[model samples]
Target chain A: MAHIELKNIRKSFGLVDVIKGVDLEIFSGEFMVFVGPSGCGKSTLLRLMAGLEDITSGEMSFDGTLVNALAPSRRGIAMVFQSYALYPHMTVYENMAFGMQLAKSSKEAIQERVEKAAELLQITPYLSRLPKQLSGGQRQRVAIGRAIVRDPKVFLFDEPLSNLDAALRVATRLEIAKLHHAMNSATMVYVTHDQVEAMTLADRICVLRDGLVEQVGTPLELYENPQSLFVAGFIGSPKMNFLNGEIASKFGANTIGIRSEHIEIADRDGSWKGKVVHSESLGSDSFVYVDIGMSGDPVIVRQEGTRHHNPDDAISIAPIPGKIYRFDAAGKPLKH
Target chain B: MTLDLWTITKRTAFYALVVFIVFVAVFPFYYAILTSFKSGTDLFRVTYWPVSFSWDNYISVLSTGSFPRNLLNSVFVASVTVLAALFLAITASFALSRVRFRGRSLLLMTILAVSMFPQIAVLAGLFEVIRFLGIYNTPWALIFSYTIFTLPFTVWVLTTFMRDLPIEIEEAAIVDGATPWIIIWRVFLPLLWPALVTTGLLAFIAAWNEFLFALTFTSSNATRTVPVAIALLSGGSQYEIPWGNIMAASVIVTVPLVVLVLIFQRKIISGLTAGGVKG
Candidate 1:
C-alpha cells in the first residue's frame, strides 16, 4: 500500500480546463472516493492518479516518490472501468491471469493466483466461461478479479457498480466492502456520481464541481456540516432544499440554513409561512414542497410518515432551535 | 380472405422479381460453362446445349503452352497480394481505429481518397516505376500493382470493422498491463477474423480479375494473369476466337471465386450492411 499525494493537479483540454488546480492527500490504505455530477472531472482526476492520463500540470507521488511520468502498470495500480472491461475472447481465468502472464510468471503461480481471486469474487464457477457468457454482475466480479490478481499497491474503481441492477448493486457493494476489508492494506480510490455509493463506500469523500474541489470530509461530516451550497445540495438525495430568504433579522449577521428534515410543520406561529405545493410519500417519510413567500423556488420539508399534508394547504414551518446552519451570501458557512 | 390473397400476390411478385434478377445475373456464367463443353464449331452452332459433351476443350486449354504457366502465375500473384494487403491493412486499420495521435483524421482521409481513385490514373507512373525496378514481366509486378488497387479498400473496410469493436475491451487490456501492440494482436486481431476474411477475399477476387494494368504491363506469357490469358485466347490468330478454350479457362478462373462467394456471401452482406447502416 502507498500514500498518493496530488499537488496543484490541473487538467485542460485545449482551452477548456476540466480540472482546476487541486491539492489532495490520500493516505495509505484509505478508501477515498471522489463524487460529483457528470463532467465535473472526478473520473479525470482518478485517471490522472492511475496514469491513464497525463498530469497536464502538477506533481503526483506514490509512496513519497514522484510517479508523474510513470505508466499505469509501472505505477502499480489496477483500474476497474465502469464498463467492466473484461476481455471478451478470454475465459474469466485467463482474463484474471493476463497480467501475470505478461510478467512471465510461472504457470502454477498464475493458476493459483487466478483461482484465489475467483474464490474471493465467488466467480470460481465462471472461470472457464467467456465474458459475454456471464451475467452483468458476474462480469463485474471478473473485472474486479482481474485487478485482484495483479495485487497492485492501489485499486481504482471508476463507477464500477453503476452498471448493475439495483439488487445486484447492493449485493456487489457489500462484496466490495468485504473485499476492501480483506485487503485492508491496499489503497482504493473510487469515483461515482451516485451519492449513496459515495456515502456508503468512502472513508472520506471529495465533492467536486466545475473542476474544483468543493469539500473533502467524512460522509456524515459533509452531510452535517457542508461548507458550501454545492456540497449541501450534492451530498443528499431529494437534494438539500435551498430557500432564497435573506436574514430577516440576523443574530449578528448569520444567514440561516436549515435542512428539510430539520424543519417542523405546524398550523400557526412559526418563523416562516408557505402554501404546501407538493407532497411525496415514501411510506416511512414524506416530503412536502412548500412555496414560501420568499424570492425563489419552493422549500422542501421532510415530514414524519404520520404527518398529513396536501398540495395548496397553508402551512407554517420553523427550524428546530439550534439545528439551523448559517451561511454568508458567498455560500460559505458562517458560525452562529 | 382478402389479407391472405394480398399476402400471396405480394409473395409471388417478390419471388418473380428475384428470379428475374437471378437469371439476368447468372445466364452469362451458365452459358460460359456450357460453351466450354462444346467443340470449336458447336460454339457458333446456336444451340443451347452441345450435341455431344467432350473434355477436349479443357485438355486443350490446360495443355496450350503458356495457359498453364499464366494460370500458375496468376495464382501466385493474387495469393501474395491478398496476404500482404490483408497483413498490412489489419495492422494499419487497428492503429487508425484505436490510436488518438495527431494527423489520424488526415491519414484516414488520404486512405479513403486512394480507395476512390481510378486505377488508370496511376497506371503509367506505376508502369515506369515497375520497369525501372526491373520486375516488369515478373509476378512481383502484378503483386505490387494489385497492392496499389486493393490495399486502401482493405484498410478502409478493416478500419470500420475495428472501430466497431467495444472500446472497453481495449481498456481492459491496457489495465491488464498489455501494451498497445499486444492489445492489437491478442485482443483486436482475434475478434477481427471475420472482417479479415471478408476483406482478404474481396482483395483476392479484385486482383484475380484485374485486366487493364495486367494487359498493359505484362508482355510475356510467364507473367500474364488469368484475365489477360483468357482475353487473348484465340484460334491461331485474330481471324477466329477459340470460344471453347476461352470458355473453359473462364470457368476455371471463376469456380474458386464462386465457391468463396457462396460460402461467405452472408458474412459479406452483413459486414457491408453494418458498415453502411451503423455509420
Candidate 2:
C-alpha cells in the first residue's frame, strides 16, 4: 500500500494550462474519487498520478518517494482505462497473466495468480475467450482482473464503468465496491463525472474545477457543509435550488440554496408561493417542480414515496428550518 | 418469377462486361500456358484454347542449363527482400506512428518522397551503391535494391495500420510492464498481421518480377534471376527466340505468386481497408 501526495502539481498542454495548481494527499488504503464536470481535468490528474502523463511542474510522491520521472510500470501502479483497453488478440486468461508474464514470474505462479484473480472477478468461465467475444461488462471485468494480477500498490481507474450500459454499470459498480473492501490495503484513485458514484464509492471525494482543487472531504462533509456555492450545488441530486432577489434578501443573503429534499409543499404559512409545473415519481420518492415566480427556474421539491400534484396547482413551499444554505454575491457561503 | 425483357437485357449486359474483363485479364496468361504446352509448329498458331499438351517445354526450362539456378536466385532474393523489408518497416512504423517527436510528419513525407523517384532514375546511382557494397553480381544486390523501393511503401502502410491501433492499448501494455519491443512483438504484431501479409506479399511479387536491376547488377549467368533468365532464353540460332521455354518459365514464376494471392486474398482485402476507417 502507498500513500500518494501531490505538492503544487501543474499540467499544461502546449500553451494551454489544464491543471493550474493542486495540492492534496491521499491516505494509504483510501478510496479517493475525483469528481467534476467534463473538461475539468479530473482524468488528466489521474493520468498524472499513473505516470501516463508527465507533470508539468511540482512534485508527486508515492510512499514519500518522488516519482516524477518514474515509468508507469516502475511506479507500482495499475490503471483501468475508460475504454477497457484489453489486448484484443489475447484470451482473458492471457490478458490477466500478461503483466506477470512480462515480470517473468514462474509459469505455475502466473497460472495460479491469473486463476485466482479470475475467480475473484467471477470471470473464470470466460477466461479462454478473446476480448471481442465477451460483452462490454465481461471485458471490463477482465481488465480489472488484469490489474489484480499486477497486485500493484496503487490502483487508478479512469471512469472504468462509463462504457457499460446503465444496468450493467450498477452491477459493475457493486463489484468494484466489493473489490475495494477485499483489497483494503491497496490505495485506489477513481475518476468520474457522476456525483452518485462519488457519493457511493469514495471514502473521500476530491472535487476539481477548472484544473484546481475545489474541496476535498468525505461525502457527508461535502453534502452537509459545502464550503462554497459550487460544492453546494454539485454534491447533491436534483441540485440545490437557489432563490435570488427579495426572497434571498429576506434570508439576509445574496443567494440561498435549499436542496430538493429540504423543501416541502406547505398548505399555508409557506415561505414562497408557486404553481406546480410537473413531478417525476420514482416509486420510492417523487420530485415536484414548482415555479415560485421569483427564481427564473422552477424549484424542485423532493417528496417521499409516490406523490402527485397536477400541473398549474397553486402551492406554497417552505425549506425546513435551518436547512437553507446562504451564499454571498461572490458565491462563498455566508456564516449562519 | 419470370424475367422481363429489360431484366434479361440488364443481366446479359452485366455478364458480358464480366466476361470481357475476365477475358482481358486472363488472356495473356492463358496464352502463355497454352503455348507452354505446345511443341514446334503449334506454338506459332494463335489459339484460343489448348491445341496440344506436352511437358517438353517445362522439362527444358527446369532440367537444362542455368534456369534452375536462376530460379533459386529469384527465390532467394525475393524472400530475403520481403523479410528484410517487413522486419525493418514494422520497427520503423512504431517510431513513425506511435512515438512523438519533432519533424515527425516531415520525416514521414520525406520517406514517401523517396518512393516517388522512378526506379530507372535511381538505377545508375543504385548500381554504384550495389558495386560499392561489393554485392553487384550476387542475390544481395537485387535484395538490397528491392528493399529500398519496398521499404517506403511497407513503412507507410504499416504505419497507418499501427496508428489506427488504440493508444490506450499501448498505454495498457506499458502499465503491464511491457517494453517497446514487447509491445510491438506481442501486442501490435498480432493486430498488424493482415497489413503485414498484404505488404509482404506485394513486396515479394515486386522483387520476384523485377528485371532491370536483376539484369544490370548480375553479370554472371548463374547469378541472374528468373525474369532476366527468361528474357535471355535463346534458340538454336541468333535470329531465333525460344518462345516455348520463355512461356514455360513465365508460368513457373507466375504460379507461386497466384497461389500466394489466393491464400492471402482475405487478409489482403481486410488489410487494404483496415486502417482507412475507425472500427
Candidate 3:
C-alpha cells in the first residue's frame, strides 16, 4: 500500500483549467472518495493520481517518492472505469488475465490469479463469455476482477457504478464496500458525483467544487460540520434546506441551514409554520415538502415510516436545537 | 378496385426498381463470366445468357505468354500492399485518432489530401522513387508504391474507425501496463476486426486492379501485373481484341474479390457504416 500526497495539484486542458490548486493526502489503506457535482474536477484529480492525465503543476508523491512523471503502470495503480472498459473481444478469464499476460507472468500463475479474482467477484461462471454476453453489473465485476488480479498498491475507481441501473448500482455498491474490507491493505481512491456513494463507501470524503477542495472529512463529519455552505449543500441528498432572509437574520447569520432529517414537526408551537405542498413516501422514510414561505424552494422535512401528511395541511416545523448550521456573509460557517 | 390497383402498381414499381438496380450492378460481371465460357466468335454475339460452356478460353489464358505469371504478380503485389498498408495505417491511425498532439488534425487532413491525389498525377514521381530505390521491375516496386498510396485511404478510414472506439478501453489497457503497441495489438486490433477486414479488402482490390503504376514500373511481361497484362492482350490483327481470353483473366481476378465480399459482406457493411449514426 502507498500513501499518496498531492500539493497544489493543477491540471489544465489548453487554456482551461480543470483542477486548479488542490492539496490532499490519502493514507495507506484508506478508502478516500472524491465527490462533487459534474465538472468539479473530482474525476480529473483521480485521473491525475492514476497517471492517466499529466499534472500541470504540483507535487505528487506516493510513499514519499515523487511520481509526477511516472507512467500509470509504473504507479502500481489499477483503475475501474464507469463503462467497465472490458475488452469486448476477450472472455472474462482472458480479460482478467490480460494485465498479467502483458507483464509476462507464467501461464499457470496467471490462471491461478485470474481464477482467484474471478471467484472473489463471483464471476467464475461467466469467465468463458465475452464482455458483450455479460450484463452491466457483471461486466463491472469483471472489470474489478481485472483490477484485482493486478494486486495493485493503489486502487482507483472513476464512477464505476454510474452506468448500472439504480437497483444494480446499490447492489454493486455493497459489493464494493465488501471488497474494500476484504482488500484492506490497498489504498483506494474513488470518484463520483453521487453523494450517497461517497457517503456510504468513503473512509473520508473530499468535496470538490470548481477545481477546488471544498471540504475533506469523514462522511458524518462532512454531514454534521461542513466547513462551508457549498459542502453543507453538496454533501446531502434532497439538499440541506436553507432559510436566508429574515429567518437567518433572526438567528444572527446570513443563512441558516438545516437538514430535513434534523428538522422536527411541531405539534402546537413551533419555530416556523407552513402548509404542506407535497410529500413522497418510500416505505422507510417520507419527505414532506412544506411551503414555509422561505427565500427559495419549499422546505422539505423528513418524516419516519408511514407518516401521512396531506397536501394543504397546515404544519409547524422546528430545527432540532444546536443542530442548526449557521453561515456568515462569505458562506464560511459561523461559530454557533 | 381502384385502391387495389394503386397498391399493385406501387408494388410492381418497387420490385421493378430493385431488379433494375441489381441488374445494372451485376450485368457487366455476368457478361464477363458468360464471355469467359464461350469460344471464338461467340464472344462477339450479344447474349443475355451463357450460350455454351467451353473451357478453351480458360485454357488459352492460363497457357498464354506470362498471363499466369502476371496473375501471380497481381496476387503478390496486392497481398504485400495490403499487409504493408494495414500495418502502417493501424499504427498511424492510433496516433492520429487517440494520441493528442499538436497538428493532429492537420496530419489527418494531410493523409486525406494525399489519398485524394490522382494516381496518374504522381505516376512519374513514384516511378522515379521506385527506380531510385532499385526496386523497379521487381514486385517490390509495385508493393512499395501501392503501399504508399493505399496507406492514405487505409489510415483515414482506420483513424475514423479507431476514433469511435471507447477511450475508456484505451485507458484500461494503459492501466494494465500496455504500451501503445500492446494496446493496438492485443486490445485494439481484435476489436477492430471489422474495420481491418473492410479496409484490407478495399486495399487489396485497389492494388489488384492498379494499372498505371504497375505498367510504368515494370517493363517485362513476366513482372507486369494482371490489369496491365490483361490490357496488353491482343489478337492476330491489331484491330482484333482477344475478348474471350481477356474476359477469362478478368473473371479469374474478380473471383477472389467477389468471394471475399460475399463472405465478409456483413462485417464490411457494418464497418463502413459504423459511427456514421448515433445509437
lDDT of 1 by residue, A1-336 (tens): 989999999999888899999899999999999999999999999989888778889999999999999978888999888888777667888889999998889999999999999999899999998777778888888989999999999999999988889999999999989999999999999999999999998999999999999999999999999999778888887677665445323533334557888888865444678798888888899888888877766788898785667788888887677877666678787775
RMSD of each: 3.2, 2.3, 2.5
Give candidate 1's whole-model lDDT: 0.85
Complex DockQ per candidate: 0.39, 0.47, 0.48
Chain A alone, TM-score per model:
0.94, 0.98, 0.98
User: Which number leads on TM-score?
Assistant: 2
Docking class of 1: acceptable
| Candidate 2 residue-wise lDDT, A1-336, digit = tens | 999999999999999899999999999999999999999999999999998899999999999999999999999999998888888878888988999999999999999998999999999999998787788888888899999999999999999988888999999999999999999999999999999999999999999999999999999999999988899989989788988898899889999999999888886564688898998999999999999896478999999999999999998888898998999999999998
lDDT of 3 by residue, B110-178 (tens): 878988888889998888888899998999999998998899889998998899888988898999999
Candidate 1 residue lDDT tens string, B1-279: 999999999999999999999999999998888888998577787667547699899999999768988888888988999999988898899889988899998998998888777888888899899999998888898898899789888999899989988776676677677898898888777777788888888899999999998898899877898899888887888798888899999999999898888887665443221211111
DockQ of 2: 0.47
True contacts kept of each: 0.38, 0.49, 0.54
Per model, state how many residue pairs clash. Answer: 0, 0, 0
Ranking by TM-score: 2, 3, 1
| Stretches > 4 Å off in candidate 3 | A267-270, B41-49, B237-240, B266-279
| Of candidates 2 and 1, the better by TM-score | 2
Which prediction has more favorable DockQ, 1 or 2? 2
The top-ranked prediction according to lDDT is: 2
TM-score of predicted model 1?
0.93
